[model samples]
Target chain A: MKKLFFYTTLALFFSACNKEEKQNYSNIAIYGHGGAGFESHTNRLPANSFKSIQKAIEVLNADGVEVDLQIDSNGTTWLFHDQFLEGKTSGNDCFGERSTSYIKTCNYNLGGKIFQLQELMDYFSSLSPKPKVSLQVELLDRCIDHSLLIEQLIAIMEVNNAYDWVQIESDSPGLLIQLKAASKHFQTFIRAPDLTSCINLCSENGFDGIIMNNTDVSVKDVERVQALGFKIALFGVASQAEIKSALKKHPNQIQCDNIELLHRIMKQ
Target chain B: MINKGTAFILSLFLFISCPTFGQDSLSSNIKITTHFGYEISNVGCYGNIGGQINYKKFGFGLAYILDYSDANGLDGPFGVATTLSFSPNHSDNKVINHFINLDYRITFHQRFCTFDCSQKYNKIQELNIGYGLSIKIFKRLSISNTINIGWYLEKSLSDRTGKTISESGSNSLINAKLNYLIAK
Candidate 1:
């Protein structure tokens, strides 16, 4: 008789606990982030100046980002995407014009100055809603400098635990392989140059996110890749239609050259 | 012996009081009530009392409830609502009422609140199955008090969140209503 009472009481207690847990899981919202203009453009001011990107992000209610961060010849990191700064900056062809020290004074004609990787970290952490905007630092210069870049970026991320909000991405297979060895704990994206390769690489490396160019990729591609439960990121978006279409597919992030249009598309 | 006697008396009192503790006679009324009463709860609360014109088959109501809390938030939920009630004898005063209701309180659209991970709003629809007593006070006016036990499902819902957030628990509503019949 005592055993019977004990079993019945235990059953009721567990049933109540189960009911409470079910109630807690009913409120999750899966929001998307990113559009074009994440890279390939120069800030007319200090690279640490978050005005353009912040305003661009405001429209999308973006929670994640796949941005381009370039490491200059002098070992300083700034957000840049173009191979040359001729028309983009002050028309000086500043890509190989000067060392990192000299370019710091050149003002890349993008209205902003170059921002150290640390400045980006500080700006992101101070936002009110605190965008979960994960970064996909694109390695532009391939002089085997990713080791140093990873070390610096991870230091900032680890100091703030910003790794939770940022994911490192690179198109180079060699760079990705190096990153895999350097920091097994940090999430990395293998930015596929094409769809066929995206599937092949993502399948092997077990990438947490995929960063792709928006020009060739369609919304269906975003949907297909996202269906695999991997986060989708659209790279190289220059048109409003491309950005809007990818937004419909709800990619995890969109990397683009036009920040103003990306912001407008997000609002629409 | 004395202690045993005292314990016996206490048990006897508890047994007698148990049945009489809860509300007597489950009287459910399918009345379209425009409540001008205080709305107070986590979802939202206000106090704006109103009345309802209810017939045997349908009910229409208008209510303006105000929040007494310092938030000073007020809501005027004015709409026509219909109630389907099951009462065996419509003319009888001491009748038992059972009802299921879908109450839609309209308001400005905003981000929804959810418990845990699932989002749910206050457009709560209740499928209640309980017994209550209906007391007839006047010619066309009657007073009813009831405690209903049921689940509040989403009513007039636009968004379907894969599953129900809260399961059927002790979602019991205690209501005291005076209903007037417009026609038979």
Candidate 2:
């Protein structure tokens, strides 16, 4: 018995660092990150707003949308992408960085103030589809009371009743693990850069999936991670050639910066 | 108690068997190496700087690499790696030499933080084994290249999930280094 166990361990160490097999790739997901916000381009709606969110869903026909999430000191959750308001907003500083009162009244360059997650939920409720979306929340390493942060995020999602379609993503492994601990069904993912790391992390932890940047991942990488049963989200798309290359790879999800362009390309 | 004893004995045996364990303590060399590596499985490139300390056939080294921004919005990724190598019947010499290696790497990347004013970075750790060939040139310099393959265990990921992640097919793990003999 000891010999058998020893040989098994040896075999795994030598041969099982990674594995791959052929699988069909017809069905995949397409998501518009930050509502594919390009005000100068086709969609006139501002990014991360109700207007663009709807446009991304109805006009662009994206399967889902990736939204930036920030929680203020008062525990209010805002849905914007940047760390600061510079270049994105007409405001002087960060929306969540300042007082909640300031965030509520603050003006933005894209045409609106920092909106709450409840408003996003209400808007989705008004729609027929409720727009499948993922919340890419930033994990502030060294932040205090991680348990409290998880509680607050869960409470917000619960009150908004967004538990069904909303998923959560972060670059921090610790944050993602805590989230899964809070709720097994609250789907979580890591913004994975290394294929080996992502697979090793997600399968060992409870992460439902991983998001890989297009530059760091290949078509074959998508297949391999997916084979391990972790959903693969190909993110940070810019040019037409990159998206074209993404299509050939057939990842489980594609987070597009140019929503309308991606929609058009996918349709063709 | 039995498990602990067994583990201690095993470790002691391994340590005593190290290549430099019985060699003269005065015969040690130090080298600094700069490397550029590319991982073709996912199509990424990196630049690295490494420092090595050796006593006869056994050597240890540390390396660091930082990734800049790319068109795909992947940037600010950095890694620090440590390596342990032992020459297989081939220590310092004019002929070709072979070395076996055990490597550990920890990588970090930037992420925006919510609910606070501070910035945060996430980390990933990996372990790999390597094989290399090296030769001396110019009497004071050496050029070496290595190929490595091994499994990685991402922190919190494997500890929490209790499962391992695997990659498919062969991953390109090639690196070339130019070592400048710093001390002897």
Highest lDDT scorer: 2
lDDT per residue, candidate 1, A43-88, as tens digits? Answer: 1222223544443333323344444565656656666555555554
Candidate 1 at residue A132, lDDT? 52
C-alpha lDDT values of all predictions: 0.47, 0.63
The CA lDDT at A237 in model 2 is: 82
* Model 1 per-residue lDDT tens digits across residues B83-164: 3344444544444444444333332212122222233222443344445456666655666654555444323221222233
lDDT of each residue in A1-268, candidate 2, tens digit only: 5744664455445344323443443387778878745454223346787656654564445667888887655667778777676777766564445566767776666466667777877776766556678888776624223455567788877777777788898888888887787778788888866878888889889788888888888878888888888888888685667777787788888888765445434543
Residue A201's lDDT within candidate 2 is 85
What is candidate 2's lDDT per residue for B21-140, written digit by digit as tens?
A: 334543445433333333211112444555677766788887665442232211235677788999868656555788988876776644322123233444555566789988778665
C-alpha RMSD in Å of predicted model 2 compared with the true structure: 20.9
Model 2 Cα shift for residue B24 (angstroms): 99
TM-score per candidate, in order?
0.44, 0.51
Candidate 2 regions off by >4 Å? A1-26, A38-44, A141-148, B1-184
Relative to the true structure, candidate 2 reaches a TM of 0.51
Error of 2 at B8 (Å): 80
Worst 10 residues of 2 chain B by lDDT: B154-163
